[model samples]
Target: MRRREGENREATNLNVNSLETLVTHIQVLSGNIADLTYLSNVLKQSGDWLQSEQTRLAPLLGELNPSMHSLGYLYILEAHISAPISKEQANELLLSVARFINACTAEQIHLAPEKFISVCRRFKDQVLLLDEPLRGVAPMLTALRKLQTSCEQLTALHPEFLLLCLLSKSYKTGLSILEDDIFDFDQPHDLFLYCYYGGMICIGHKRFRKALELLHNVVTAPRLIINIAAEAYKKYILVSLIHLGQFSTSFPPYTSGAARKYLKNFSQPYLALVESYDTGKISELETCVQTNKDKFESDKNLGLVKQVVSSMYKRNIQRLTRTYLTLSLQDIANRAKLNTAKEAEMHVLQMIQEGQIYATINQKDGMVRFLEDPEQYKTSEMINCIDSSIQRMMMLSKKLTTMDEMMSYDPSYIREAEKARSIFDFDDVDSLPLKPDIDAHLKDVSSSYDIDD
Candidate 1:
């Protein structure tokens, strides 16, 4: 009886733990692309055992090439992330992972996304450890393209790739990704990194309005942590002063409680300068800047602070545009507090060249004449701008309508809305759960991009 029971147990163990069985099962399961997600769940459920089976790692990875068995290869790679490796082995692993990421079947990998992002993150860590961020840039960009169903989709890759770009000073390439309006994100931290890094890229380009919008996203996003928000608020104040020519003393209503209370404590110098800006006196702004010059230098915002000081002169000159039709260069300099008539002429010429103001400066007489904005709203460029604006609005409206329809089908969403309806004076739209789908719909729109491609 004991021998019979032992034989039965051995048979059961072979049935479940046999490598041949798993290999055959993976091959058959991978044959049908549609079953990839089920395979992913199976791997996810077995992740701990897989992680423990480091002895079988070689044979398993050898049998599962990424091109033929992308899901299996990815799972093994994910498992290997936690396993120990020497520096030399890690360098080789980096190359192998990059190859797997580049050559793996995207549709298969996307279905078994359980560890694809984590694996990508490991690749980034290896790259950073090697101190070759530039080498990481192209691979990360490829990983992002492979993992996303749309270029606009935000993932953990967004922040990592942006950091690589920032380190490599590939600002133009980074800006390319930022052109897409990212409404879909896997995590709030991803969104924060996207906005914060994206804002810095925009600042590099001197796209101040776009920078302000991105930085504002980080500042106002509802988060328990305040470190990133505090840094963003510092930039936000400087960008507001530079781009808008002034900062608003009124606080934004939607800012989270943590941000409202703590961000101010770290950014007192910036806020004081805003007060100086409000006084509409360059001398006070100058004094504030000089007093806090070391702080600004430590913050690496000295350049922007100088621009703010210079912008005050421009703003003061622009105000003169409203009140005076004409003024001699010396008079303009005195009013705007410039050092000389030549300096006043230079500012006017730059402002006019930039379409910030309409004016003509006569070098002969040193007189400046301010005129109404000369834009006629009739140029081909203006018409194209208007058409593009209208098209973007229409596109956004359609997306909102589609999302609303999607939410209406979610049972949890319906229950939440019903609860809201049961409450009195519930006018806030903030109660609804933000997007419901984690691995959202795939390449549904013909206009949409495919992960497989």
Candidate 2:
């Protein structure tokens, strides 16, 4: 009996020791997988090797123990390859892999919720590559709910995540979540999320100015929970400018930051205006300008916005122009009426300074208006040239003809000419007439400097 009991105790100790050994091996594997992540980071450095290694590891992930996190680590490493993995294949593998992680996470929750959280977070990191299925927004709403629950359970402080959830919810509903008064703005972290979410919601609702203000606050927030917040802020500002109907400015919608990756895609909607406005192509401008006119007519400050749009486009608005005002500055000011003469003047001056408008100051009235017409200006110059040339022609004809007549009949002039002819060789032939080469000498002298051809 004693020997049997001792053997049983020894066997239990042996199993625990073996489990420790397994954990150690899993940790080493995790380190190796981390090195693989660096390869993914330097994609251009070892792309071929990384791809082959990724392919080799895909099948091995299924056999790893979830508690060890080897499987989760491998899945994430594969996800970072930057090449398109088959979505269907990724979906199948990730769903099963995520489920395994979830089960292991649930088991570990009581023992250490932080570990479970870490495991669950890895699924999110990898699965972001998956395209969200197009549905009636139910899946996104549900996902937001799940994320909220997870955030609560895991004690995560990711402001951008929370903001995205609120934004997705608001976009899906077409209504403000803040209207229900569920938001707690006193909490800095929650406030950060609320502002970002509210801003995005405003964008969807086409309240671009409001959205800009909200995004600005979130952008300057001291504790940014995500690296992309600054970029998101810039995009929001640009989009707001577009929403406000400013399209002539050179400020594009997406430039640097997180938007740099998606700029190519985000740029498509504004391409027509970009080409038209940038190249000064009148036909394209007409089409795009018309589109913006129609869009802003539905806005609350339609009258004021319409005038500004017309002035910039030199006709009625048609399509929305992503001009700088609409895309960058207008959103910050909301859709407030820029109707006052003073305000309009300031706006026009700003446009002029931006080289979008050309204006001249009327010193008499202290007013600025569009620069003078080119054709009309040329005509005025031509009129002045013709007037000056007519006066000069009259003076030249009177002086030269009067001088010629005087010399033709002068007795002293005839006697001197006769004497010179006698000395030159016989008073033969009439004294050579002194006719001036007038036309040739006067060819370049003009009485008028007119622009008319």
Model 2 residue runs over 4 Å out of place are 1-14, 17-89, 97-113, 133-170, 173-198, 205-217, 223-453
What is the lDDT, from 0 to 100, of the residue 42 in candidate 1? 60
Candidate 1 C-alpha lDDT tens digits along 137-254: 8888888888888866897788788877766667788887898977687787678768888887777677889999999888777663355567678888988998898787555897
TM-score of 2: 0.30
Clashing residue pairs in candidate 1 are none
Tens-place lDDT per residue, model 2, 166-213, is 323434453334333232232565565556656655655556666776
**Which stretches of model 1 miss by more than 4 angstroms?**
1-29, 34-42, 53-65, 84-90, 323-333, 340-349, 358-372, 401-453
In order, the Cα lDDT scores of the candidates are 0.76, 0.42
